[model samples]
Target chain A: MGGLQAGSVGAFKGRDVISILDFTRSDLEELFEAADWFRRRLLDGNVPKLLDGRLVALAFFEPSTRTRLSFEAAAKRLGGETIGFTSEEAISVAKGESFADTIRMLDAYADIIVVRHKYEGAALYAAEVAEKPVVNAGDGRQHHPTQAMIDLYTVKLLFGSPDGLVYAVLGDLRYSRAAISFLYGLTLYKPKRVYLVSPPQLRIREEVEMVLRERGLPYREASDITEVIEEVDVLYVVRIQRERFPDPMEYEKVRGSYRVTPELVKKGKPTLRILHPLPKVDEIDPRVDSMPQAAYFFQASLGVPLRMALLTMILGVYAG
Target chain B: MGPVPDSELLVRKIREGTVIDHIPAGRALAVLRILGITGREGFRVAVVMNVESRKLGRKDIVKVEGRLLKPHEVDVIALIAPTATINIVKDYKVVEKRRVKIPRLVEGVLKCKNPTCITRKKGEYIRSRFRLVSEKPVILQCVYCGTLLHEDEILAQVLGEQE
Candidate 1:
């Protein structure tokens, strides 16, 4: 956090939050500092009404519950309003309206747009169409900027910094946007090593691996989680995305391929923390949820303040 | 330049058209497709393939009669044939000749191979767009999805084969 003061938040004003790669290390540091400030203020029962008259449009072309609610909750806590549809079927898109038209409508209605879509570049397309700042809640198989922010903040909260930690991103590396964004976020810092664990069919994309190499980040790819289970400081898990598989048989073959259990947790260092962008399906055994290593719930809760930090900065309302 | 080989002389010189010489061997069809010169276009086209050259070992050359290429068409040619030299023939003399230079941005020539990319949506009316990210290896990144298209993908898409 060295020269990154609250005033550094000015750079983010009216900027689109579409990809983690767009952010620099100091930009992340500034955001994390703001999130930390919001976290403390919330605990003290002082909810700032900084965005008193602003409106946040949630244009989710795909279905989502946790992400939609957290954004709504975040905006409400900041005394802002939230609007827009959760699914394509719930809006004019069901009548065959174009994605750009949908985004244009949201832009007309709100100050900032939070869009989630099944297509990979839908958020980028929305940002292109809309006048308002666009935040990508998630995009197909690659970007989830705010989720990655909360995740890095969680790591910072636990280990005091995201740097110099050995991380293994387990499960659907190919199809999981959260996992891929987390990987992209890791490139912003210096990690000791990262183990990409997935079945060969679901291996990390060559393009992503190329970026990781370009960043000079140390990494290894493995088929099994146990290869680095004992050495990793953080095990970031994501569910196998069944819907993303073009063939049902391919989905069936990799389903339940990796699981975290209490016995499996016992093999790791006591300080090892486990994280998942949840609504998981049979990936993490319910028994492990009670363990000290289960930091996913705490990670999920931090979504509020992290998003609050983002909204305030993007809306240009952060006086500090 | 010593002498033109017998194979190179098979397609006689054009008096008033364009000669695209020194294309990477076996890429003449791709160059034709980039130029939209399907045999249906009815222009007198001579494709000489695998001609021996000191600089390129073996290369393909395309000589078109009664046709001049548009700038954008030449730009697309530069994508697949960086070593290609475009010579505007006038009265059987090479009036203008210049090696192809890759453009800073390319549009509608190559499709993003990413199946889930928004630009691939059926009714979106979005044209494919790519930025020239690297010239040596010929990398094109989709402006929408940020998916990279290397030389092979670019060639395939330019040849009208879907990935």
Candidate 2:
């Protein structure tokens, strides 16, 4: 594994990552502990030389700007090589091959498979078929488990468990699978309240609502950001839904509706933390990126260490 | 067509045939949607819908008489209704009885939802997939668009489009 080193690969030996919610509370705590180790190792310039000859396969059928590069970077920093197709055009998949066959073919070359397809459950299905660890990068509008992991890490680092602290998830809750999965995960920690802020059409999903309700987790809906600003501990935001708002007129109507500007964050208490899943058009104002409340930049940077920690643990290469 | 058979709706016993039993209530018609069985089938197909079953509140049974069903057709039987039990009736005797397993994906269970999807919008043939999210209520996916639709959703979309 040229993308990751052999020495630091601990606890994470041979695990399939189909969904973020699949992890038990213990499972995550273990990974976070490993991440702390990876972060420290990376900080000291003596990174773990685990996964020396192992290869990481990245088969992203859909578009991903940050996730694709970050995984490769994580692998390289750990002393492993990265390979695999970014899209269907590069493989026999476009020539009409079954996902089963494509995965079986890649299984021969890579120890771990990281896939981001447009179909929901694609990664889960792939994990069932492949004889290696499968990481779901993004599946349809259903899940982005890795992003949720990094988000949770950032959140944990910020308010120190902030369990019972309120989080206001604003913007496109409907098409934002990342937001949906993250909200599902938040239930595990027992937050005080979760304000599912969205436009009327972008209501929180029934499945997510059911999961939270079943767990006896308290959550409410608010269409306006003002309703959440005063009391929110964390402002979790998702990307704009350009795909859904096809009508330019309707887009114009909602263009500036829920933006989290630096001015807006400052208007709230100084302690309010703003986090985004990123690649934002206008949901979060750029000026807010520099605000004290802006934790997304730090959150984005943490993805490397968090994922490195997960990869290291899944591969199981404890230090000598 | 004719007011179902006196014995059943679409089938009669044959020298050698496959008996599909233990289907969920009102899904005998859905078995036809799988396309393994003929609409105007040459072989006699007996459909017993809404019949009482201890396991299922009410169930369906399709008995194909005379010619034995091919293995691929048997596989399709498993894909259509996981609850369906297949019995190899040879020489008018129940040689084997077993429950069917759900296939990972249905080749063409129904129509894809996305109107703009290349498979649905312009193509003469469209292949939709179902990932079996829930067993009681079957679910399939539009390969092009990531839509989690119930089996009834597929029937509504497909049958509605045909109408």
Best prediction by lDDT:
1
Which prediction has the highest DockQ against the true structure? 1
Q: What is the TM-score (0 to 1) of chain A in model 2?
A: 0.91
In model 1, residue pairs whose N, Cα or C atoms come closer than 3 Å (at least 3 residues apart or on different chains), thus clashing, are none
Q: lDDT by residue for model 1 over A75-160, one digit each (tens)?
A: 99999999988788888778888998888888899999999999988888888787788999998877999999999999999999
Which parts of model 1 have CA positions greater than 4 angstroms off? Answer: A1-9, B1-18, B24-29, B36-73, B88-95, B133-137, B160-163
The DockQ-based CAPRI class assigned to model 2 is: incorrect
TM-score of each: 0.88, 0.75
Question: For residues A60-156, what per-residue lDDT tens digits would candidate 2 score against the true structure?
Answer: 8877878988888788899988898788888887788877678778888888889987665567667767787888898766778888888888888
lDDT of 1 by residue, B1-163 (tens): 9777766569777888889999989889889887778888788999998888778999999999888775566867988788899988889998888888888888887778889999998669788888988898899888777789998777776656522
**TM-score of chain B for predicted candidate 2:** 0.70
RMSD per model, one decimal: 4.2, 6.5
